[model samples]
Target chain A: MTVQLQRSATVAGPVRRVRRSKHRPIWEEQPTIAGYVGKTVALTLIVLAVLYPLYTIVLTSISTQATINAAGGLVTVPGEITFAAYRQILSGGIVTRATLVSIGITAVGTLLSTTVSVLCAYGLSRPNSFAHRPILFLLLATMFFGAGMIPTYLLVSHLGLIDSYWALILPTAVSAFNVLIVRNFFMGIDQAITDAARIDGAGEWRVLGQIVLPMSKAVTAVVALFYGVGYWNAFFNAMLYINDNSKWPLQLVLRSYVLQGVTLPGSGVGQVDVASGAVTGLPVKMAVVVMAIVPVLIVYPFVQRHFTKGVIFGAIKG
Target chain B: MSKQVADAAPARPAGTAQRGTADGGPGGRRRRPVTGTAHRRTSASVPVRKVSMWAQIKRDRSLLLMTVPVIVLLAVFAYVPMAGNIIAWQDYSPYVGIVDSPFVAWDNFERVFTNPLFLNAVKNTLLITAFQLVFFFPIPIALALLLNSVITPAIRTTIQSIVYLPHFFSWVIVVTVFQQIFGGASQLHRILAGHGVHFDLMTDPDTFLILITSQAVWKDAGWGIIIFLAALSTVDPALYEAAVVDGASRRRRTWHVTLPALRPVIILLLILRLGDALTVGFEQLILQRGAVGPGAAEVIDTYVYYQGVIAGDWSFAAAAGLVKGVVSMLLVLGANKLAHVFGEAGVYQRA
Candidate 1:
């Protein structure tokens, strides 16, 4: 009877395999020609919706002044491409300064935010740890409620964080949602390994540093990406706190120059004097726009694979 | 609202390792996840001991210390700010401060509710959110279904990477991209002008609703699809096989077996969206509010900013913000209740 059951299980596996079409199950009907064409068209439009504007803007940024004028607006096709916009902006100006500022914030904020959140998550991971439930409540409560903008601004002001770079980082640093997700992951870890380490004379700190974290690299990386992206793309915080123009991050720079009708930095000349992030040329403005997009384009791919990995998806299951 | 975008990674090594151990271990009621070191496997082998809370605290001092920074941050930045909401009742003054500011009770609330500008802002915020709810919400679900049909893993992943790329983009970039393409002197405009036709899009208040909604779809709809796709991938194929064996057609199986699998995720997203009803693109609106004029663009967020931060009407702005926060909280709570009635988990669970 055991032999017969084992033989049937082996047969069932192959039978299931026989019905698949590479990525799809054979049970689903084959898509119609019309449906396939419709799908392709729809997908192409969606891809183009994101890519085309970006393509044109990036193209315009690099295109020579003559090419820009010939195109009469944003350049779709490249002509005598030059890195003049890049050269002018990156040389030494508010644009350059803002770029440095943003990089610093993204780097520092990601480190601080990731470390704090990971520590918090690990601290709460142990089932029945001291005050774990109440601590978890204290963190999760912030997710449901926020101090309105007025109060938050006032707090920042009173703390003398207004116009300070720390204001952007500190006020919104601890993402409670992140804490919850990481905590869930930590709790999901087997307790036996930690207990073994504990018996072998490893303390909680040593065990976390040596064992739990090495196993948690995936979630930690993903959490860091979230904070890094948050800091890099942060505009509203800068808008609210930093009235000092010199301390402006890239998003605010992009906003004031590009979107709000291009008052411009130091407008004119083939070699534009880009003081305080002003620019008359569309290429320079588009260059700044490219600056805002490049980091996300670079970093998101590495983090992208983790979406299917399920450490994060498990938290969503909650 | 928060950048809690689709974070669906599979289990880490520790989790799978734990699951392996669970499968090999004893099968009994003790297998359940009861808290405390008391019932843990290692403790079982070592002989469990009943420990006091103070002893537990002393033993777990390092772990507790690790959580202090976050707890302190929440207290100072989050909880303290909520406490500061009281200034809404007072005629708040920078010179006098909160302690000395004269209290006026509902007068600030009355002024904010009565102001036509604030009313217009509320009207515009609701109108935009409702329009996007109808038009923009389903695009991601459709996209997920569409992407799911591709019989190639490489192609599906590539499409996903390209599509969700826009979620990371700042509002500045999103608006700039739209403006360069659809603005009055834009690519579309240039093409139309060559035919001697005139139509304005970006800066036009008349078409502002369509413009911003398109931006919303472009920027967020792709990111929003992540949760749905994750849900789709989790649907058991056995259910479909059973449906097929029951004489259900492909269409019926998709409608019955596949779509229902997505019901919880859809309901959760809907609850979250409803909770954010008062907050329709604060950064996006503020960036473009000047172009379309406040008549068509102001939201409660910008109203609060303009009133409190810009105009120095701290009391009035604080009241407006308080009203928005209260209403948003109620909306989330109410929607979660509604979700519970439908047998969905909604966003969070009481249990």
Candidate 2:
């Protein structure tokens, strides 16, 4: 019984053992006190390097105008805080319109891309399917070689997709990379089940819709989030294809406001706006940045758990 | 948890029976003949059997129907633009279109090679690529190594999640965040002003390249560590135990075991990065171009955009873009060959 426990402890490894005790592996000697202090300092500094900027951005966004002015731009310390910046941005205006536009684009784009990707990926996943090799070769070729920017722009313009939301969606509609990842996933499914469905007189569509997709919810969710975040954060396509300012997505608005320091017509109007002596003060600008980032932040935890699997499927397989 | 089990299921053929069939074990009776032929070959192992064209189409009719939209989308969006690259050799006018445009054989290529601005863009791109390869490449490996040493799963996951979060953010947000903290009128500047120290690092042209590369590292270093961590996890734990039994120290074990395990992944990523060297962040540089001026920020991608789309020098821009595309493809092939020379499977096996 003691031997079995020792074997189990070894099998669980140092990581698991660290939770219960100060277990050091045989390969590792216990470090001096100075070494421990040095490691703690290094880790703390690294964590601070990452978290400080993010904290400042969030803090600046919430602080009142008077507090910001007293703090001389961004308030590091907690003061009279308010959600006024969030209120203003969410209030019916350009920021609000851009947010809605981004949401719409993300939704529509994710649905279309995910549907098309599923079809392509499923088709490609079947080795015995018609023209599978040639079709796959064609898809793989796109991963290496691309039609450069000018000709692509010319094609979009020639097709009259310029100034349209379709320009954003269609130009980058199906990421061959995402398709390959999904294909890798589909290939991993138990062939027995799919074959069983086929033996039961189920057609290809039925097998895909009923058996394969139902089993692939995790990957499909992960892939959808990838597409959604992609569409939400895309500003270059908007910068290129979208000629009208009113049609700009949230990222583009964030770019113009925060990066270029362009104050929107209705972005600032409150107690803070008058007190900061700037049209779009630090808080409002940071608020727009936070707004642009919030969707991604909300979805990240769910998708974070799946990225290792998703990335391994794409990277290691290929 | 189900996904993990499902993912692991494909690796062990003997474990398939335990996973059970859709209609239960008795369902295998009907599936025996079908699975005999079909299940013999896993997806990536064997090429599909060659059936008659009509039979093949009939067998895969629904799948074919499903793939039609994707094929159409790629043809229209990807292939058609490749054909539109013909305009590189023409004096292209949007009004005249490709067919009617006056052919200017070799003129655009000659112009691109001769133009000082294009040359400058190439120089800047190569410099930025070199800087990133030197500074940005090893960071994630180091971070992964650090995280690997920490034997706490909860701390590792939390730190990893924090770092990886930035990768999901668009370049617009990244650049904006940097500008907010470090721009000319930024909070940093305001703080420095109170102390009577004038500072404006954002708009400084001399340091723009470093600034942009730092931004790239901040955004992607955490994400990059995932692959390295995956590689590290694959290293055998018994190797360390054997080394320990042989009286190897931690440093010696790391040197002998850990680094060697990471070598293949490192080389693979290096080859891929070399292939993508010319494309040094178009959106990141373009968004900041106004602040630091174009001379410092224009890489090949942004150069092509500015010369082609923004300035409307269609044929000339197309010429430069075609050169970049062709060179990039060649670089990829060349790097893959180099990887093979070093005994690593780069992107794909050579055919």
Candidate 3:
């Protein structure tokens, strides 16, 4: 029965195989005349639909203030290009401060969260431990029931975390879902390697740090990206917990820009205060959207491959 | 939603490991040394046979030690706050505190149940979730099927990368993107107005559900492609080859072979989605609330925000949140059981 399962796994699994399809003839594989045309049209439509809206955002962001307003909103082309909008949003103190705050929070928060996840996951994956069942049940129960938000807020407030960065970090630092994913990945490690380490007199932490993690880099990277992206995109907690404008993350700042329809340029605000007395501000607002998304957009292409790999390896039953 | 996603992993591991150990060690480890030398086994090998719970504890002592901080944190922040659900039955005041507050005993729940506004939010949530399960769920499967059929790795990877980019975008950006094209500044709006037409969907309460659902699709559909893609790889190539030899059309082969092969995955994903129906994306609703107002866009999470946190009525907010949490938990449990009853693997064991 075990041998049958092993055979099926190798035959069916996608990740294990590396193939060279040299046996197939390229010319014969080429689609017939009608099929070629259909494929081309379908591909073209898919590409256009995805690209056009993104292109419009880029086009508007680079458009000059005068041209954008003159066009009565963005059109096919910007007619002129200017970096003044970006300069205005960037140089202004609000976005600058918020960008730094978001960076600091994401960096520190990701490290802290990932570290705790690794520790707990390593602990939970052990065969039998004193704290295993109780700890596991406690965490599992958390997945079902939470103290709700008010009790959570009261708890944080009671701890004097209100108006502090800890408010953003502490409550959300260790995700139960993320922990399970990492733990699953750890469990996938060859038991022989861990047993060999144990025979060599290595402690649990040493075995994890020296053996398990190095082999588990792919999943760890995925978890870090997940945690990091979540931290960077998080603004609700900041909005709810922190009242001070100086400490607001970029999302909250962007939200305010959208709400007020204001474009504050060169003063550090991405969206100008059109309502406050600025003319031709839509370009600036477009620039703010561009500014808000660019960092994550840059990081995304690098991590996309590993993202699904990590999720699948963690999600499926072995 | 929280319970659904979280509970699935735990129940599987806990059940399998406990049963696997009791029956004998996992099959692989059991086959090794003991079979080679039954009576000649060293004391070290025999020690496992005498395994007491305390011995297991001693073996995993360091691991147990490391799990301490995690347990404490989850207990205090995650579980302890659950007790605050009592406030949902009371008139909770921050100044008066949870203890001294007047116990309204279901008044908040009664108000939520009776109010037309609250009922609308529930209706909207269910409607949007149902639409999501139908219109949105299958796109990714179709996409994964398409991608799997494509032999070109470069094209597949590039498309996947571009599509997945939206997953990381903040709800603020997603809503802003929608507003840019559909709001006052939208290219479509200008084009329509140029052609002597007018349409306002962004602020139109009637169309808000469609708008929100589309935004959700745009943001998450690519991410959903992952699971379907994973499941598709498990389909037997032999099945496709047999169909091809029988002169089957590509579409027919896919329909007969591929779709049937995806049954387990489809059922499993459906159960998961039902479990997550309550959590209809918190940040998205909050961002769009001002435009659509409470009439079309208010939800359980946003309601808690406005009533409890924003209004400083902590008790009422606590109650609303508790109801959502409990309802979501029950939904996942029921969904898992239903999946099992249908001869599918539920979140946990087969039975």
Please write out the lDDT profile of model 1 over residues A253-311, one tens digit for every residue. Answer: 88887776546556321233355222237788889899999999889888888755534
lDDT (Cα, tens digit) per residue for candidate 2, span B1-351: 212222222222332223223322243223322223334445465444433333344345566667777887898889999999999999999999899999999999999999999999999999999999999999999889887876657877888888888888899888877876787656677778789987677888888877998899889988899999999989987798899899988789889999999998998898888878788888888898888887988878888899888899999999998898888888998998999988888888956
Candidate numbers, best TM-score first, in rank order: 2, 1, 3
Interface RMSD of 3: 5.8
Model 2 accuracy (lDDT, Cα): 0.80
Label model 2 with its docking quality class.
acceptable
Q: Candidate 3, residues A92-211: lDDT per residue as tens digits?
A: 578778888888888899898888888898999976555566777677777766667778888888788888988888888878888888888888888999879876767677888899
Residue B71, model 1, lDDT: 87
Query: What is the lDDT, from 0 to 100, of the residue B305 in candidate 1?
Result: 96
Q: If the candidates were sorted by their DockQ against the true structure, best first, what order would they fall in?
A: 2, 1, 3
Off by over 4 Å in 1: A1-21, A267-280, A310-315, B1-50, B194-196
Q: Is the docking of candidate 1 incorrect, acceptable, medium or high quality?
A: acceptable
**CA shift of B332, model 3, Å:** 0.7
Which residue runs does candidate 2 get wrong by more than 4 Å?
A1-27, A269-280, B1-50, B191-197
Best by TM-score: 2
What fraction of the correct interface contacts does each predicted structure contain? Answer: 0.74, 0.67, 0.53
lDDT over C-alpha atoms for residue B103 of model 3: 81
Alpha-carbon shift of residue B116 in model 1 (angstroms)? 2.0
- How much is B338 displaced in model 2, in angstroms? 1.3
Q: Candidate 2 lDDT, tens digit per residue, A36-149?
A: 677778777777766787888899899997888777766789888899888988888888999999999999999999999999999889877667888888788887888998
